[model samples]
Target: MNVVHILAALSEPTRLTAIHIIWDGGEHCVCELMERLNATQSRMSRHMGVLKAAGLVVDRRDAQWVRYRRNPDLPQSAACIVDAVIAATDVAGEVAA
Candidate 1:
């Protein structure tokens, strides 16, 4: 994945948080994300779409809902950037709390 695309995808607060949540090493359904992020189904789906397009995440169809997880095929360099972004935001979140 292109570094610029990954960074751009994470630029939005909602999308950033979505990635943070999804990065927990488990697939996340859109409904779960919607509740956690206090977002509408449509809103969450749209944000996930952006992440998907950026190759930051991959999705699977699960009946009525779409589930997402960090792209396992992400290049090592791209993974490093994602790690940094998550770490930075994780710290920021802790401080804010």
Candidate 2:
């Protein structure tokens, strides 16, 4: 994973919100994300694209739905960046729980 690129992706507020939704809920479909984030598909997908490009998110095909999950094997910098984001939001406990 390109750590720099991943960190860049995560540097945006809306994308960070997307990460929080994905990381907190574990694997989730696009629709699930839409509901949780109250975002349009186009907007949600835009954020997902950034995460995918960063190699911080992975996808699975299940029927017509595409599910997304965190890529735990991400580069060190990406992991650290995510860790800090979660810590700042007090969302890391949701991850552990």
Candidate 3:
């Protein structure tokens, strides 16, 4: 994955949080994310699109809903960047708390 593209996609807070939620190891549907993130359907879809374009996530069509999960094919280097970003965010959140 292109580091610049990935970083750019992750620049938004919603996209970053979406990545963290997807990384928690399950296929999350758009409706689920909308409720959890307090975002509208369009907003969640837009964020998911960014993550998809960045190659950070993969989606599956489940009936009327789209479910998202971490991209299993992501390279180790790119995955490391994702991990670091998530960890950094977690630390930052704790400090803010």
Estimate TM-scores for all models.
0.90, 0.76, 0.90
User: Candidate 1: lDDT of 3?
Assistant: 83
lDDT of 3: 0.88
The per-prediction tally of clashing pairs is 0, 0, 0
Name the candidate, 2 or 3, with the larger TM-score value: 3
lDDT of candidate 2 over 1-97, digit per residue (tens): 6767867887766677678777763898988888866778898888899899888898898997788998867767767778786667644444234
Specify the highest-TM-score model's number: 3
Model 1, residue 87: distance off in Å is: 0.8
- Which residue pairs in candidate 1 have backbone atoms (N, alpha carbon, C) closer than 3 angstroms, thus clashing? none
Per-residue lDDT tens digits for candidate 1, residues 1-97, read 6789899988888888899888887999999999888899999999999999998899999999999998999888988898899887763464245
Regions of model 3 farther than 4 Å from truth: 91-97
lDDT of 3 by residue, 1-97 (tens): 7999999987777888888889988999999999977899999999999999999999999998999999999999999999998887763353234
Query: Model 1: runs farther than 4 Å from truth?
Result: 90-97
lDDT of 1: 0.88
